[model samples]
Target: MRMPLLCIVSAVLCLSAASGFAQGESPPAPAPSAAEAQSAKQPVFNQEQLDQMLAPIALYPDALLAQVLMAATYPGEVAEAVTWSKANPKAQGDDAVKQVAKQPWDPSVQALVAFPQVLVVLGQDPVWVQRLGDAFLAQPDDVMGAVQRLRQQAKAAGNLQSNQYQNVTVQAAPASTASSAPASTIIIQPADPQVVYVPTYNPTTSYGTWAYPASPPVYYPPSPLYYAGTALMAGLAFGTGVAIVNSLWGDCDWGRNDIDIDVNRYNNINVNNRIGNNQNTWQHNAVHRDGVPYRDNRSRQQYGRQLDGASQRAAFRGDDAQRAQARDRARASMDKAGIERPATSNRQARDQVREAQANRPRATDRQPQARSNRDNPQARQTLQNRPNNSAGRARDNAFEGVRSPARTTALADRGRTSQTLAQRPNASRAAGHAISRPSAPMRRGGGGGRR
Candidate 1:
């Protein structure tokens, strides 16, 4: 009885495989059979021993982990079922036994049990399901031959039989004839209703109709380069593997479009504040390629505007402590204006010009004074009253260099004469004539035009 209890408990270890297990849970070992007693030497497997055995293989790849777990769980359940069958030979397998029996060591069975109820769980999880099926079909139960047939069909003819598991049958009992009938005394009829009893045998298996397990691992021609080949194929099959992993680890991407939409909308509201659209470019190119996006632009814009309004209020609360905050607000406003500016706008450049104008000085900074002018009557009369001597004129010209008084007078006279000539229509011709006038037969005295 205790042995049976132990056996049943051992079957319970298979439950860990049913649900995705934590890293710490250990798989149970196959129960030892009586035949092993004759050997006098057999390995004893406790829970710890089972844990140790399963631990090394626990970190299988995501595509293969479900299969590994199923493989680990199947042996113990099969051994328990075998033990139960041996113990109660006459008794029919009950619901529990039948249920255990129904768990055909099939990969698809394991996958179905492992995943939560979802549509895509079936379609996209071929590799994982195949891994499970491979593990199940390879189990040491007596179904190997039948599974082999199925596998052969899957391989060559691309078809599997419907009755691979329906071979076991039970015969009906014959009618009892203990009491004999009297000969014509009562014109005896054949015993009215002879009842025959037939026993029904149901064998649990995964080989029946429509029980096609998941697709098997696809094989292709091997490339000469090892790592390159591995990386290329593995990357191509990565979606399948990743999906299986997500199912196992409970981390899948969903509602991706909503996230993308939200991000774009947020950027749109702050569009003026857009600093070169790096985020948008990243979202469009890398993020979209890698994952899904959120909802539309309107929500994001509204959210950003709300944040801006709240910050502005906090900035304007007139405490000296808020001065820095106010400066930040001003800076944010300018940034916003810049961001919102028209594509062809040059408002910022104009602001720079205004700043420069504000720093320039007015003309009132200089002192004022008068220059000697012949237009003054006194200066003109003085000029007219001067002796008309060539030597006097020469003296006047000499004084023009210094002394500040007569020098002003001579300079004034020269200025007046220059103005008079400048007013003439032929001023340039008159000046040329004056310069070219042959200086008193310059051959006698000096270099004239040369000076």
Candidate 2:
């Protein structure tokens, strides 16, 4: 049986109520053909498509990417989980997921409380996960721009409809023309990053009625306005979003902690036999997933590397075809960091991270505060697992007398900061500032912790 054209193509084109596709007055640019994505030798993406690909998680830092990736796998519970997280931030990792145990969401859905926006988008389109992951690796900064622009485009084309995307139109100053004084941009503030309310207008009034006896076209906030919205969105909402997601951040902070890349898990999903898990692979994933039907030289090179000797003239060396593909990818990545994706963590990304980390208190300075009496058997046990208070006479935790397990568990990331502090007798008493055990972030409070 033949599949429908819209089914095989973009979710945006279907315009069904479930898809939440907004129908605008103008005839859109022709949709890309199905084969253009499925059969191309390489993937190609324009700025617009890339922007769409990156919308969900572009505003997130590298730290939260892992959780978003994992959480996006189960979208239905995203809203409940986010709401619950706002109420209970201290619950972390395993504990965090337990709160929503009866919600009937996948266990994975519980992990996304801190990343509500990602959850909402995943709820809208979980398949977009592959693209969100790819974009984070290649262009961290552009993530925010991509999110705003797509909504703007979607609004312009009348496609912003979904649980996460809302529409709002308010009367504001109009765009400046030579005849009229320029107007200050109208920034439509987001109710939350998880919910984007686009500001649009009936084009007939704004641009004057045209002769075409057609439906009134809707004009989205302009591209410049969308770009401005990106900044406004981040300035206004990213902080709250990050605070919520911190309950999950203990495991998700990829750059801060050691990431044991499940080489096999990642490879299994890579499907296309690509070489090294680098920026090139990220691009390859983005291009191919979007169905551009394009596979560039880098992808070919990575696949070629899977051959016996790679480029070496050894007995197991790959054939001429593999060598050619690898060479092609190598050349492209040489000059500009854009398309010529490399086979490792991007240098620019790494440098930005390094600079950012430089200001943070060093692991040595930010030692963990472990109880010195830990070995004395009288150490305060974790009350975290205790049952509801005992009017009914409930017992204390069985794991009693154990020193702070959270301290030890949390220290594993910060260069064993807890152990370092534990070794020095009452270190904070002398330093005057208690090197508090990096606690599970509170759901809400005046905040402080090592980033």
> CA lDDT, every prediction?
0.32, 0.41
Model 2 misses residue 8 by how many Å? 56
TM-score of each candidate? 0.14, 0.23
lDDT of 1 by residue, 75-127 (tens): 33323333443444332212222233344333212222222111122233333
Q: Show the lowest summed lDDT stretch of 10 residues, model 1.
A: 181-190
lDDT of 2: 0.41
Residue-level lDDT of model 2, residues 221-280, one tens digit each, is 322322333423211222222223123321222122222233343343232332454521
> In angstroms, how far off is 167's CA in candidate 1?
34
